[model samples]
Target: MGRFLLAIGAPPDRASDMWKRFEESGAMRLAVELEGVQLWSSVDLPLSIEPGGSRMILGQVRSRSLGDDDHPSGILPQHEQWPSWPKLIEAFWGPWLGIEYKHRSLRLELVRSADIEMPCYYALAAGGIYAASDADLLVAAGACTGEIDRAALASALVYPAHRPSSTVLAGITELEPGRRLEWTPGRLRGHALWNPWDFALPPAQIHDLQIAAETVRDAVLIAVRGCSAGQRVILGMSGGLDSSIVAAALRATGAQWSGVTTVSAEPAGDERYYARCVAEHLQVQLAEVPDNIERIDLRQCHAAHLPRPNSRSFSQSADKSMLEIAAASGAKAYLHGGGGDNVFAMLDSVRPVLDRALDTSGWAASQTVCDIARMTGRSVVDVALRAGRLALRHGRDAPRIGNSAFLSQSVLETAEFPHHPWLDTPPGARPGKVLHVNWLIGIQNFLEGHAGQGDLPYRAPLMAQPVIEACLRVPTWMWCTGGRNRAVARLAFEAMLPAQIMTRSAKGTPTSFLYDILEAKRDEAREMLLEGNLASLGCLDRDKVEAALGAVQRLMSGDVLALMRLIDTESWIRARIARQRD
Candidate 1:
């Protein structure tokens, strides 16, 4: 959540000069290099060292560690700067960007937490690589060319979750979640810090519901407490199991926190009843902000400054309200249950049934079929028959997120590629787990940066690395226990949440809100897209897009969502064009 710039694999002079180059812009004031390590960061206590220094440790990271109020801002305690300090962060866990460097050697390693998404980018510069947590800084420092990357933009438009490394900015690479890069002069090595496949396909999978529940509970608490330390947190609560569970953790942490829920005028978008129940149960003050679409600036494009257009038109109202609440109340962070569904294996498919049959014996498998049948409203025979068919004949059956019909076939045939490295698992891998991992891939863009929320750090604790790992280890079938999706998670917070929230089957959606936005901004969106880069760049088909927008009233909810995504992307593209013209 801190803005930083670093020079890796550069000669000493060039590496040392980066501080002067970026900082002289008055953007990065003071907080310069760590003497031996050339990292200049805005985070005061950004580095952590274990007391024993025995093995490279992740728990020792001050900001990410639990119950540590002393350096809650994390790691900067004015200790003597070590020459090897940067290198020690090689295996650094959690949602931080760590760069390992040797003082004068060509040896350098850059690592970041896969727990939550932070915008980090690196561009190969003259004789070295210049990296930064903010893409603008890299572009300003001449590390990035400042030119837009239309090819990457094409992939993002068709499928936003297309790839991890490629960013909307061309020539710049995003250090993806749970991944690391090691540079050794001639060759650069990069690999995943953690793999969901390992958790899904293994004897390591958590089969016991009790154990899985306990593990999830612990991980959630750690993720919450670590981020909540020394900070007043404003939680985005939706009376849903995920946010309610987060509320429970906030209660346990004894931190200064409050729950804020956005009330939608549309019935489908409203979840106040559940939010109120949880707040009353937790005995916390709840602030309900009504979603006001009239308040949204149709002409304003939030992704104007972002590396990509990731923000939605809906959040323009909700996030504005939350930003005001957090600012007025002196809160330093925002927490939400954004990725709970995916992390908890909330799938609509029969993969859970298939997964259950794979590991369980006759009675357990039979019970699972019944449970899945009840959850999905399918007959037991149908569930069993489907599971049998999937198990018997499959190369890799993990469902993939397909491109929308609005996209051009040329873009589909030519630009299509494997969206994520983790998506392609080894042969015989469980499609259920692959499907679960796919959920994680799809939700990556939801990890919004602090910049969008008035500089207050945004925390998605449920999506944190430890919590993700714990849930990934959980057997896919375990989520459907007692015929409930995410039953393990429900079990984890059974005591803290209200009974109604624990058992509620329905969840809110912005389908109506999407329709509302389209109706309200239909003309604006039409002019924007018809004249924007998406159609001109050959990313989306013009006639199809025109039909989706022109017939907004008659279009389905999914089509509306798709159109909104294109508008947001087109808005970003137009903003970039205007900036260049300026």
Candidate 2:
């Protein structure tokens, strides 16, 4: 719900013109200009300027003992007097972006938790360092070039779940989480301020599960209550353990909340029964938005400014319907359990357990083997042998890049697609750390870049840093007990959630509905991809695209997701090209 543009080295006149262009784009509801930075934001953002100072803070900050001192304005005085600004910034919890100015030097900081969700993109253009929350805005303001970054585009196609720090525009780089960028005189520097991995501790060090569960519950309640304070909030209830836990926590706080869920006609895609169960248990009115696959429109779903195509296109109509209901209900913010799976419920992976066993004691290894045997219904000998093989095979490896049939050979050879760093990390380092980072980056990017475009502020209480850190402290064995994924979370809320929801193992799949939408709009997609801007740019092969369309017409089911990704990429490329020309 907030957007900002900052130019560090540009002349005053050029900065003013860029500000004017952004203001005219209808993207910002308020505009502010300081010595060198110009900030534009939506009305919902809690933007505060320091009294008689060039420092400003945007978004809400939450603390346990701070009381009203948690507000950014109240905390600014302490930060100003502190010797180390980065250390002070790192100690707080909340979603926020901060800007500080002194003696003509400008510094921009993105909170380590990335809960406030501000994507910063910068490039050396027009004789200055220009940065903005929106990448397209930087290009449109003539502060960044319009030329596409081929590597970034390829990365999107290959690794859709990973959020690359670099953007699709050449020479433009996104500020990574827990990082800061500063510009002064003729020099600019960027550095990392914090790393969550540094705080991770071995799960065995924390012996008590009850204490952990209580701590996690407290964190969730604090986050939910803190973010939804004095506001009408919408809870996205899916009847799953994650959403249900959030609903139960909100109900415990006695906050003003309503439930909204998307229901599909396809039984495989429907979860209304469970949703209704949760809503009834909470005694809250639930609004259902029927996702009729026939209403899919590629253009309507296309988010032109995003770095890549996302699930927004797949759920565009359904989300719009849900948003309409939320807006009509007078909600100020929409809350959901986005990162619950990544944080609380980690997937069952034996590699990390085996890796830890090999590096540590044999007693620990035996315990893990016994746990695996119990969970997988396999013999101890079999589990131990398998674990040994996995441990021996464990090493750094490059990510598996999927081959796109449509991408031009020349582009593929020349583009330096950035590799995912986690792919090279040691397996025994810490369980769920890599997955947590992936979810944080991916979800934050989607929410800020695409979902925040809605009328109300979109919030995720389950994604709070405190909750995530608490979950990370949980051992891998506890997460997947008895062959169940997210076992810890299920056990934590056993008394709060209904038996059906708390024990439900299977999740509803939307693949069928997605394919149906693609088939429903076959003709339009064909024309768009066959002669689309992406094909003209040599990013895709026209012949292969036509073949894919033919397969879709025949109801074939080979890599349909990849085909959809191609369509999304082409749609975004066409829209971006149009914007550049404008």
Best by TM-score: 1
For residues 1-582, write the lDDT of model 1, one tens digit per residue: 667666554556655466566656655544434443455566432555433331111222434345445454445344434334334333223556655556566667776656554556788876577777756667655676557776666666667754557677777787786677887666777887656676677576987779999998988887788778777888998878888999999998787999999987788889899999999999998999988878776556765656777766667888788888998888888899989999998988777766665677656778888988999899999998987887778625555466666888777766545457887686656667878888887776766622355366777888877788889899888888898889999999998888999899888876787788888887888887777677787777889988888777899777887887777777766766776465
Local lDDT at 524 for model 1:
83
lDDT of each: 0.72, 0.64
Prediction 2 TM-score vs. true: 0.87
Stretches off by above 4 angstroms in model 2 are 22-32, 51-54, 64-84, 104-113, 201-207, 355-386, 396-428, 431-452, 541-548, 553-558
Q: TM per model? A: 0.90, 0.87
- How displaced is residue 381 in candidate 1, in Å? 3.0
* Candidate 2 per-residue C-alpha lDDT over 7-59 given as tens digits, one digit per residue, 9 for 90 to 100: 65567777667667756876665456656556667666667556665556666
